[model samples]
Target chain A: MSGDPILSVDRLMMRFGGIVAVNELSFSAERRKITALIGPNGAGKTTVFNCITGFYRPSGGAIRLSHDDGRSIQLERLNDFRISKQAKVARTFQNIRLFPGMTALENLMVAQHNALMRASGLTVLGLLGLPSWREAEKRAIDLARAWLDRVGLLDRADDAAGNLPYGDQRRLEIARAMCTEPALLCLDEPAAGLNARESGGLNELLLSIRNEQGTSILLIEHDMSVVMEISDHVVVMDYGVKIAEGTPQAVRDDPKVIAAYLGADEEEAIAVMESGT
Target chain B: MSATSARPSHAAQPSGSAFIVKKALISALVALVLFSLMIGVRTEAGPQGGLIYWTRFGDLAALVGTVFGGSIIVELLRQWWGPVDKDSIVPKPVQSAISFAGRWLAPALLVFAVLVPVIFYDQRYILDLSILVLTYVMLGWGLNVVVGLAGLLDLGYVAFYAVGAYSYALLATNFGLSFWVCLPLAGILAAFWGVLLGFPVLRLRGDYLAIVTLAFGEIIRLVIINWQSLTGGPNGVSGIPRPTMFGIPLDNSDNGLAARLGIEFSPTHRLVFLFYLILAMALLTNWVTIRLRRLPIGRAWEALREDEVACRALGINTTTTKLTAFATGAMFGGFAGAFFATRQGFISPESFTFQESALVLAIVVLGGMGSQLGVALSALAMIGGFELFRGFDQYRMLVFGIAMVLLMIWRPRGLIGHRAPTVYLERNQSISSDLVKEGHG
Candidate 1:
């Protein structure tokens, strides 16, 4: 489905003091596909996500993001906000970092800040109540409303993001990331605390985003059901190194992936995996 | 275990009169310990230039007796009313009344402000006081951009004010520039300083940012004080030009506004003009801030406050956002400073002190941070309330401190604690202050 991968990491390395958090990890996520990074706790999946999103600078390696327009960006070279601004990479936190005090609609509106900022002539024309600025603001609100409708939170647009129910907040967060119009979306543990039904809903949302919006998603998830169901490609890690990577069926059958998840012997892991499936 | 539980129940059911008496005795003892030195002692200088001291045991006893009686009555009332609900200290009706007042208060205050100069045209003191109050309101509004909206705690806001005042003073005195020309120039210069201050403190937040800004303010004042060649050092720049109505001076001259209007030339006219001038400037600051709040940049500022990391994730350039906030706040401070220079006809480094910064910050905080109406009302209350307690002289600050403590206890988020959403869909709902975060920086 791709001429070239949307994102590729080459021999990435990250170190915190003497501890190597990630070591010589390499992976590529194809455009318009859902790529899931799965690992046990502290397997450095989030570190990889952080490096890709420019939250942390890797000690050694290259993170290259290719745009649809043939613009290739070295994500590691960019700073935190610039990664999102120029590289078209948007991410949500594991701990849900929505602007808690702001309304749900405002949360989405803030995501479109860069575009509206330019349309408002850096705020001067907007201050003067110019029609152009008003038009841009109206368009932004419309986009926000559309996202809210998609997330089934149109009625709750005016409610504070913090006050939303857990499932609603999770959906709202995804909607917020979408509002940025990012080419690549990174989500950290999107279904971490969701119930079975909520996670099922999340799978549908992620699929729709891929199918309808054509936005490539790179996610770090511990929930296997979410990882296997929606992920077109799966990368499994253990102790900061990629142990297995393939389609969901192949990775699920990988003995190393099961051993890493269960921390058991290869034979036992395979037996346990077979029984669980 | 049953016997122990029964004993506890027996203690809990102690007669009300006995329980009240026990509580009153404890309160009396505590009051005696607290006021023993403060109210029970008297000290004065002897005629021979030695210190003399006396004890007011009788007065102390009377105070202790009053406290004991007060405690007993309070205990009795508590028993009659049952346990107080911690959540609802003020009744529902009272809260609704306050909200109703808050909703209509802004327009009412504006109407009252407009009428002040007209009604008190002959009262020079009230006119001067009103001008002073308006000046603080403008300053509070200016600082609100940096501190309240952006969530940056700046302790050196007076630096911008000093910059503006000196800019106007040097320009008007040296180049003979009018107030109209210097006002904008001063604001620009102060904004430049704001950006200068902003750069070094970009990585800093909360108390550290506050400290650096506080130092920046002192540095500006110290530079002005020590730079004798340009600023005249402690002597200050005197003979600053006064403001005029367009080209017409508000003076007793042939080409003055009074003569042109064919009205009697009086000093009261000038005071009235100054009042109107400051009022207009304050309103302009309010108008611009409110409009800016609905803009992308304004929302970005709030988002930055709510969560800096989240802002960066959303691709907001926090450096520029913080710098713009600082520059905007400083520009208004500069405008107010320029007005101060013109109104006084003199400029001094002493005028822009840490105390001035503290006063303006106090006004902003007391006014509930971002609310424009709250800032204006707080300015009036602080300035006018200070004058109201002028007769107390020494006890003024003591009373003010107690009042401040009471206000903090009652409304920790300052007056008008609830935040009105800048832009909302459908019905606009006010957010409780408990949900709002005071920005880290």
Candidate 2:
């Protein structure tokens, strides 16, 4: 898990007619680490994630997920369900895609729908109003309750998910993904609406998940505190190019990383870094 | 992580006292229905005993329960749960719709149902019209699955109806099959046809699906018309058997039913029996459908109807779901068709036309796309009303057009349109708490 890459994406490209949203991006995110992809607006950060998650079929790239047989297969060729269920990649949305019409508990349970499919088995079990379906339904509810508790939302479990406060909705989105028990969790803008306290709690939640469940995290966050405090390794990009990658401290000082963040040319970037406010 | 700090407030939430009262009202209404139905049956049928007594009471209870229960639960939802759900299983667009339509449709439906019958007293014509309404109710329920639940508009649904009627006609004529046995066979054959129709339109959507299905119906009709050997062709098949009592025909011949039973008989008895038979079939249709609605697959169907993309993302196999709807719905349509063949004892290719599909679709939509009771009411109004209007001669279609326009303007979603129960409870869960219009809003 330390040196071996779990997800290796190479030379990924997504072209819409003439414009390239993601241009030849390449990176490897290893197991059980908080890897941050930081870039300015329109830097193709989210597009790259979409390609890996199989929401978009990349035009030219190899996204290989390491398997138990010590081989890798291209992820881009897989369907969305295959990426989610087979590749074990769970994701949240930029706009908080909780099923608004369902209760919070149901939203969480739907995330674990594939698990319930086993209870509805081949024998006369599911057809006869069998105890197995009942048991499975109960188990699903219990698991949802546990997740709600983890997210500090147990009291609001029965509430319609749309009614939740903005902060709780964010937390529930994360809890819903964890219900899938995926190998790689992709969070798109988790820290978008959070204040200092909520952001801190999010940081703590990610750190605990990484430590306890051995789950690798790939997060897109604009919050500097969240990105810098929790991220073990940061990949900085600008104008669809990977400018620098290393430990946070080293990348923070790099001329290219500084230029990218400041939206400046390299020469102007060095002048600002040299003046050193 | 959200900016909504401070402990979440429950200040705006309503209490549950009203829930109890609503339940009480429902129970009382059910009791009244039992009492009224029994009195009505005793006064009308001139005798009372067996399941009719129970049925009279049971129907009374069900009618009372559904209405009282529907009203109480809704009021409680508003008072206790908030008119616009902070979070509800209904989509936002659908919720806004239910709210907008509910404001006027309720009173208009009641007024029309009561006033129409009172103003028209032609009993002979009314009975004929009532049967028509019942037929459409059956058809609407069948089409609801394909169009409303599965979101598949089928312009060839009448093909399955034709199959049922033709199968019953052919089998009973050639081999002398009983109505009961032929009934199941008709359903099975129709389901087969449904699946066959389903395969061709798997990739089609909207108008494309509609056109292909229309072509399928036309193909079936042409085959019936052109098949010179098996089918009688355009002249159609006649002298088909009417429903009988143990090989005894209802005619007043030497060995007919009256002579065998040694009792004077009227043709109306058989008509009544046929009525009961179709009534039972319609009830069975309703029961099975209601049960299916409670299943996970049923919920998934509704979810799919709402959003196909989200349904797929949930890992539901859309293909299987669509096929099941087609098969199940087609089976019911066949059952109705078989009954039609047995009753009329003749069928023609002319019966399975594009207009038949339009009538059924109208029944489904006018009753509110997914409402069972609504469908039944719409059937009664459209078909029964149309039949009753026979005395008007040439004015029937005009009345229908006027009524339809008025109905649309009054309740655009159709009568008793698609409304799912707002509250779900365990078997032992009492309705005592649902008495008022206020609770955890």
Candidate 3:
């Protein structure tokens, strides 16, 4: 938490035709910390995640990603794939997007495509089965194996990813994103379909990633248990605008945060309902 | 309790015989309507050059009766079989047996292929047919890299074939280059066109990509036909030089290969040499593809096929992945085309039509996309099967169509539906085709 901000968002805005999906929003993610973005449905949490990950170009704002080596990237200018490649940012979809036909190990191996592509000399050396390519391939397999082991899917390495259980698929996806060795991991609802126990396991996994790998995490979650327990900082949004932002404890106690989740005071809700009727 | 009392639903079920009769009657009615004109009526030119008409009521009735009987038999089999499950039509034991056969089929076919030339060296017809089959097998393998491995549906694969053929034809006829020298040049030229095709269609997917590629093929063919001065237009280029055994020409002259080796002269020597030549080239294509599947780029291609969005998210440059796939597949097509030009000693726009592309694509699809053995088997079945139906006269196409339809119904994903993972840990498992994405582009 004390390190320089790994990612800083300045006055982000996203407009889809006439509707403003995100309006002049700003936030910063501290290095090696788990930051939670919590909002009710249709609050544009995922949209912000998309903007930061380069899936969408923000209408107005600058996303700056600073590396430990003193290099700063303007993510907004980069293409979708380059965000992950050069900017060192990785993300997982709310709906799992694993390469279902490939094996679990292959899913991880594919995530290491950039590194392996270079080592293979853009496939010319690898096509020749050169020793250099062989060593690179072996090292890639080892890295994939290590990530698979970390996610506890080492035993099911050869199984098609589509055949894995729901909980395992979620963890496998996270492992795949980590295989890219990203400086920041953005997850959209990692616990969306998980049971209580699986969410507990996910909490431990996310904690270990931050603790051991020193990778910053930004996650959107409806699961309060996940948000409250592991998040060092929390930002709450309501109707595409930031409602509250602070430490998890401070955000939880904020009246505005409670109003956004539980709906405004009783009188205010009744008045709003009367007007609608 | 009595069986009927215990399960009242059983009593409501129609008897097997009655159900079969009802279904058969419906089929007979439909067949009667369909064949009333098709089989019952016929028209021909009379002796005076006027039209003559006749009705064959007996044949129409016979066709209807056959449909009725066939429907009854099929219904009976269905009842006896308990239930029809589309996914598991072939029982587990039978599937395993097929897979077990598949395990050894590759090497066995290789052994048989090696011996075909020797066994049929005396028969010119068999040798020519074998060369045709090998040429198609090579084409199927080439297109498999794009449509199968990379999941790019290319309806213009024949354009690359034409490019290869024309490259060799132009180089050999105009510049007096040998086939050996022009072969690689043809492949390179085709690969260049492949990359060119890759650029404009980079953003297109699925059906749009297919339409654009189809148009590309037609454009190439039309260009060849209209460019009369360069391509000889519809007449085609003839006397294209034949391939030689290294530097030795396979001819009857005193300076020929047979004379240099001190062997007796026979036209069969050149045929045998051509057979082995195409065989070696086809094998080269197969070997390179197999090797590529184990490389990073190959894995990236598969990854792109599985989920392009995921590939992009994982930092894979999908544009280059697709371009490489097109280039590689086209290069092989070029090689096959060069061999074809030399083998026939002739080339024409008619030879590189949409039908040729469709035929090669059919071999790849029927063989199972991404399965090397499947493509090879499919090519053998399709090309050889078409030739087998030669005696069917006008009914040849009808019979071939029925066979293709039956094969598709039997194995919807092709002859081999499952994909074997390129690299595996612990134990290798074949993925069901259901999970394999056909790719957006």
The number of the candidate with the highest TM-score is 3
After aligning candidate 2 to the native by TM-score, how far in Å is the CA of A91 from where it should be? 3.1
Tell me the DockQ of each model, to 2 decimals: 0.60, 0.14, 0.68
Please tell me how candidate 1 rates in CAPRI terms: medium
Pairs with steric clashes in candidate 1: B152-B441, B206-B441
lDDT of 2 by residue, B1-441 (tens): 343233234334444667557565866666575668554344323255434332355666566666666666756666665334232234557556655655556456546434433444334454445445556677789888777666677888888888888888888888888777788999999999999888767567777888888888788889988995777888677767887765677777778878788887666545555655676677778766765554455545554554454444445556666777888889999999988887777888888788998899888878876677778778877786776788989988998898999898766767754345321321111111111111000
lDDT of candidate 1 at residue B283, scale 0 to 100:
93
lDDT measured at residue B429 in model 1 versus the true structure, 0 to 100: 70
Per-residue lDDT value at B127 in model 3: 91
Error of 2 at A225 (Å): 4.2
Which docking class does model 2 fall in?
A: incorrect
Tens digits of lDDT, candidate 1, B1-441? 686574564446555687789989999999999888988998899999999999999999999999999998877776676543343123467557767887788788889999997898889999999999999999999999998889999999999999999999999999999899999999999999999889989789899999999999999999999999999998999999888888788998899988888998999988988999999999999999999989999999888888999999989999999999999999999999999999999888899899999999999898897878788888988999999999999999999998888898777888866666777889567666666778999
Worst 10 residues of 2 chain B by lDDT: B432-441
Which regions of candidate 3 are displaced past 4 Å? Answer: A1-3, A265-277, B1-22, B44-52, B84-99
TM-score versus the correct structure, for each prediction: 0.92, 0.70, 0.94
True-structure lDDT of candidate 1: 0.90
Interface RMSD of each: 1.6, 7.2, 1.4
